[model samples]
Target: MIPASSGTGLPVAVNGIEIEVIRRGAGRPLLFLHPGIGIAPEAPVLDYLAEGVEVIAPSHPGFGHSQLPATMTHIDDLAYFYLDFLETFDLREVIVVGVSFGAWIAAEVAVKSTERISRLVLADAVGVKIGDRTSRDIADIFAMTDTQFAEMAYHDPRVGQRDTTALSEAELLTMARNREATARFGWIPYMHDPKLKDRLHRVRVPTLVLWGESDRIVTPKYGRAFCDALPDARFELIELAGHFPHIEQPETFARRVLSFAGEAGVPVTAVKRASA
Candidate 1:
């Protein structure tokens, strides 16, 4: 297991699978779970959050440098893997922040784990069925041009254009593999657990639903429904942003998250503004 540079890294073993976990900063443990499909656990969003509080980001097995088991098939399998993961790490009173597909996993983990999870932040999260509106399919996305893929992934079209040309062939292939894995788990009807909306009442933890105001992928309406379903939750929209708001508006995104973490008694400092 490679050590996470920000602090002493912890090699966590769960369900016979070893995950690389990086812990940085101090105070309450805030676990950041990356979205599926080409994202490593150490995504830039996690790095942005790390500046304020202790952040634990783990690479999902089979993605990045982590080990992948041959028998895994469903997203629920990943859910259980993380439940065991939290127990192995002895992380209690945790605050989980998940983006996109990771948000779905975070919700699953919160419901299944008996531990004390203080709050949950779902940013442009999936895992629920909306009436008449279908989530994007993996197969369709794969067929699109790189520009199309970028446009769908980001709110600002320029971000997509800027990054597409620089992506190496290896990166592109990894993205394809991740998409295939996601399809195996989330491509069925609804692309999410049908009962998840009903189960929101059982979550018990305070929840924050964040969305990109201009996100065409998931739609802002879905974000509101997710927030409304949770008993103790609030929704916020990041202006001029798309699906991945944290990347598009890092400063605002991080500030809002840090504020939420603080409200949950997680002891995170407010993000400091830089001088002009």
Candidate 2:
């Protein structure tokens, strides 16, 4: 059955899958890939980015109001779907931005082809294994309680809190669907793709890797290693923030992103700064 629109976005059929996309502003095109938990179309970061450039934020298939085809089950499948999305839209010289699990998808897409993409941004990404088999690089989100996840995922746990009692049935169902989809794509390998590390070199575009200072999910050290693997990439930290810096510091996150993408609409220096 076709689902209703997620209120803030429209559903577009891409490769036979109905994907919910939140499009805002106008100018340079920027594709915003969301985290594992899915995207809230009303996210402030999207508004901030839209001030300078067009922001197209799409909920991954199986998340939000999007459809999940039976054949799509891996992160690589998402990567290819995005490639097709770019082609279908005839988008060119686009800036691709991704957060957390979405960053992994962005990386996979960039490695495969950069024909449609111009610059890339990854924030608190987790898709490559940098340690020995016994070492745990990413925190086990599956095992953590809601409180524990909030404590680990945000510098201020209050910012990540959602009152389940206040949410509608649809909202609750979407949340569950997102979690299930996340596991389907990431469970077997425990997050990291075995071959993705070796293919990092294929992402030739200039890239920016942003990490939250207080993130326990994946430390800044791990972020640096992820950046180092790329041919040309720089690492920066968002102060007083955790896994989802975009949520914790929207203005700062947008400034860094716009600055890196060379957007003239939003004028802000891009450098290492404390307290944003």
Top candidate when judged by TM-score against the true structure: 2
Q: What TM-score would every model get versus the actual structure?
A: 0.83, 0.92
Residue ranges of candidate 2 with Cα displaced over 4 Å:
1-7, 263-276
How many clashing residue pairs appear in each of the predictions shown? Answer: 0, 0
Query: Model 1 clash pairs?
Result: none
TM-score of 2: 0.92
Among residues 3 or more apart in sequence or in different chains, the pairs in candidate 2 whose N, CA or C atoms overlap within 3 Å are none
lDDT of 2 by residue, 226-270 (tens): 988877788999999999999999999999999999933221124
Model 1 lDDT tens row, 1-276: 224465433566676788667777677778777776545444566667778877887767765445678787677788888877777767788888888888988887876753658778999888876554554422245367768767877877887574635789877777666666667667674358876766666676777899999776677888887777766678999998887887788778878888998882432223222111
Task: Indicate the TM-score of model 1.
Answer: 0.83
Q: Each model's RMSD to truth, in Å?
A: 7.5, 6.0
